[model samples]
Target: MTLEELFYLHNQTIFKYLYYLLNDEKLAEDFTQETFTRFLHYEKSIKAGAELAWLRRTARNLAYDHYRRKRLIQFVPFLQGHEEQEPISPHQWLLQQEEAKALYLAIRQLKLSYRDVIILRKIEGLSIQETCDVLGWNEGKVKNTLKRALAVLQKQLGGDWDD
Candidate 1:
């Protein structure tokens, strides 16, 4: 497929995935565009039938790399941006709900592995196979990680596993 077609089909999915992972719409948008940019850089090398996986893996890496760099530079004081803000998108609305807000905070507190599995499986609704592909894990590892991640989320949310 052409880049335009691929972007049309998968841009929203990639953006939502990054938003859930980062919890920042602006950063998600930035990384979403970066992900597509990186895709174009490596498009010729990517194998057939793996475009979505390629985008997701690239996006995930970019997000994690940004987090790593942010941590390293976080101690340095910086001025806030002076630009005007854009209107909130629908994904931002979900975080405004009481339960969702609480859950989001709790998930953010979890370890990266747990948070990633939870977001991939529960929030983004990726299938086991898809999640495994995005995370570069086997199915068994994905299932086990997801189970443990859910348990941690349940405890963090102050609810029982049955809830």
Candidate 2:
């Protein structure tokens, strides 16, 4: 495939990673663009199958960049207007309002380890191995941690998290 087509194929995954990390479409879009811009240098050398891994790595870097930017931006002395809305399908329409509220509360209610597992596994769609890579834990630790995370979610959803 051509270089542009290679980019188009993996772009959605990159944006998905960014969206899960930032939980904001605009920022995800920005990071997706930045990912490709940086990727241009190495695009010629990478094979098609390897592109997904490359994009994931780029997305990870962009996520960290975003975190650093947010820390800097938070100290700003001014405010900007809120973002406008986009139309949504019925399923998405529901999550647009209520899911954010419920998810915010649920994550806050979870223990830190449980919350991290849920975010990495469910939100970012990371595999068990990727979770281990990101969190620097062993496979057994990942499995046990994931078990506890799900149990915590079950308890939280059974009460405060029902939506």
Candidate 3:
């Protein structure tokens, strides 16, 4: 597919994935753009049908690099009384809902592995196998990590989470 077509198809997905990982809309947007820019550099090497997975992996790596550089003590800025930015879209509006905010907070408290599995498997609705592809993990690792992540999330959410 052409670059424009690929961007149109996967942009929101990548952006949301990054948003969940970063918990900062502006940073997520920047990483999303960087992910695509890296794709431009490596497009010739990426296999067909693997573009989305590649983008996700790239986004995850970028987030990791950012965290390493910043050495942040806190991941969720909103909880720290960071000034709220006006919602720019329906998705942003949804993210501001009480439940979504609580969930994001809970997810932010998790270790990166748990956060990644939860985001990829549940929030993003990626299948087990697809999550494995994006995370470069085996099936067993993905399933086990997801199970543990869900349990932790449930406990963190006050054991009220249905799933």
Candidate 4:
């Protein structure tokens, strides 16, 4: 497929995946564009029917690399820039149940691996095989990590967990 067609088909998916992980719009857009740029560079090596997987893998790696760099400098106070969103109005904030909001916060607190699996598999509705492709993990690792992630989430949620 041509570059235009590839971008048209996968840009949203790629961007959403990055946004969900990073929660930073500018970074997501930057990485999404970079993924396509890298795709163009290595397009010849990608096999047929594997374009989406290849793009996703590239996006995931880019995000992880960015996260790694961010983590390294996170301790440098002056180097950090806060990018808070506009405050949620009381009405809008009240519209969401407290439990749901807490759950989301807890998810964000989980380790990167667990958070990635939960977001991709549970939130994004990707199948096991698809999650594996995006994460470059085997099915067993995915399943095991997901199980542990859920357990950690439950612990994080305290008695808020119904089951």
Question: Can you give the TM-score per candidate against the true fold?
Answer: 0.79, 0.57, 0.80, 0.80
TM-score, candidate number 1 = 0.79
Candidate 1 has its poorest 10 consecutive residues by lDDT at 72-81
lDDT of 3 by residue, 1-163 (tens): 9989999999998887877677789999999999999999999999999999999999989988998899862455233224577546877656657676788788889998987887777767799889999999999999999889888889998966665
The models' CA-based lDDT, in order, is 0.79, 0.67, 0.84, 0.79
- Give me the candidate number with maximum TM-score: 4
All candidates in order of TM-score, best leading: 4, 3, 1, 2
- lDDT tens string, model 4, 34-90? 999999999899988889988988988898798688773111001111346578788
> What residue pairs clash in candidate 1, if any at all?
none
Clashing residue pairs, candidate 4?
A: none
Question: Candidate 1: lDDT over CA atoms?
Answer: 0.79
Candidate 1 C-alpha error for residue 121, in Å:
0.6
Expressed as tens digits, the lDDT of each residue in 1-163 for candidate 2 is: 6659867787887786667566677978988988887778788876656566576667766776766777631111111113566766888866655755565565666665665567667756778887776666788997898887777766766754331
Q: Local error of candidate 4 at 123, Å?
A: 0.9
Error of 3 at 84 (Å): 22
lDDT by residue for model 1 (1-163), tens: 9889999999998987777667678988999999999999999999999899889999989888988988731111111223366777777745545555576677767788887787777766789998988899999999999888888889888887542
Instruction: Write the number of the candidate with greater TM-score, choosing between 1 and 2.
Output: 1
Q: Which 10 consecutive residues of model 2 have the lowest summed lDDT?
A: 72-81
For model 3, the local distance difference test gives: 0.84
Quote the lDDT for 110 in model 1.
76
